[model samples]
Target: MHAEPACETSLSTPPSARWPVVPLQPAVREAAPRQPATRCSTCSLRAVCMPADLTSTELQQLDTVVLTTRNVHRGETLFRAHDAFQSLYAVRTGSFKTVVMHRDGREQVTGFQIPGEPLGLDGVCSGTHSCDAIALEDSTVCIMPFGQLETFCRESRRMQRHLYQLMSGEIVRESSLVMLLGTMTAEQRLAAFLLDLAARFQARGYSGAQFNLKMSREEIGCFLGMKLETVSRMFSRFQREGLVEPNGKQIRIVDLEGLARV
Candidate 1:
């Protein structure tokens, strides 16, 4: 799932310049609607994205400081390949995918972004995007400018550690994907993918180990480096074996551990 990432500008501006000095124009100063952040403090998924030691005031500041965008339609390009990286994007809802294309006009799905996942960190150090980021469905992402993000991280050592952990998590996922593509059989690859996705959904505070698949089997085949028929057959066989229940776009993991070992 590749998303065209949001463009990020260089953070060369002086510290004082982080917040624009443009006076609030009368038109731009309308009473902004009150939209409070969901009570993440009580959510099970908070383990993945909780701000360490952040106060209620800090939470409000983070929300206010960010330029959150919404209503991005499915199949939309979030950012094109090689776009400049100036901000960190955190997905608030829906799904996204990142891809790398080949000289042969083929595409390889690199990573899938779920809610709370950041997709553009691959180029954070270099200040340029290396892949395309596209939304899989209507989505929302909060854009945090790099300079402010840096300052925030510097001020909060825990946040800096969390950022490193996020990057490290990305590295681990990529390494696993590499191994899955390099040595696993198509059937095994398919099993691993299903299991991984099931685990992901469960991590998102969902029940029945069930959710919808935004990607087609053909896209799954492309990422798995197998034929479309192979992907279909694997799914069919898994369903027949009571490993998964597939009803069009909706899916349920009936025998969770059984499917994991498939």
Candidate 2:
């Protein structure tokens, strides 16, 4: 059996004069809705997302705070660096990548968010988004307006604790990434990355051993601190060693222990 990760992991933002906000184009605003938006109590992702201990009335309160779902298309920018931040986004479907531009003009992949994941926490401390969140595919996110969320959190200890846990998890995940890049060999890093993804998918009730890669090899390499060529070579090596089987962007872990050993 594969070791489970504590929670989903990822890969933030900048400080400056807040950028002039541009309204999302009408066409972009209306991507075909995947499903009719539902209340928080009825949301399928509530188990992994909201506090598990909330009472029925508290769940109803949360539902009122969430305004609606917003659809983001492949390659669309959900929020850009320096944009004034007001809401936190919960991934209702698909995935997103958070990236920051370096002073040297290169972009760094900060994190990848799957379903049930939240983005825009970077803004809490600064009041402006420090990174850009871009959708990897057609996706939808529930909008949790921070002001309302903060009010609700104050009245419920469980919800407050859950919010702290999410923030704390983000901090720990970042520290782990630093350690991962600082100490681990390329192979170990790749193995850990795949295993992390597997655990997250399994948590979402998907097959942990098999899944599609929403982020490309280039993006994965950027996030994992390796070259694209190196990422590809590692994939080939893992395939040859029977650690995993790759068909295009889809991968299956044939030997979970073998991967864990790396």
In candidate 1, position 209 carries an lDDT of 77
Clashing pairs in 2: 11-110, 11-111, 13-130, 13-131, 14-130
Residues 124-188, candidate 1: write the lDDT tens digits.
86566666788889886656677787777786676677778888988787678766766677778
Question: What lDDT score goes with residue 204 in model 2?
Answer: 87
Task: Name the lDDT value of residue 178 in candidate 2.
Answer: 72
* Decoy 2 TM-score against native: 0.87
Clashes of 2: 5
lDDT of 2 by residue, 64-149 (tens): 88858889999998887777778898999999999877554567687899999999898798677778999999999988889999
* Highest TM-score scorer: 2
TM-score of each: 0.79, 0.87
> What are the lDDT scores of the predictions, listed in order?
0.67, 0.82
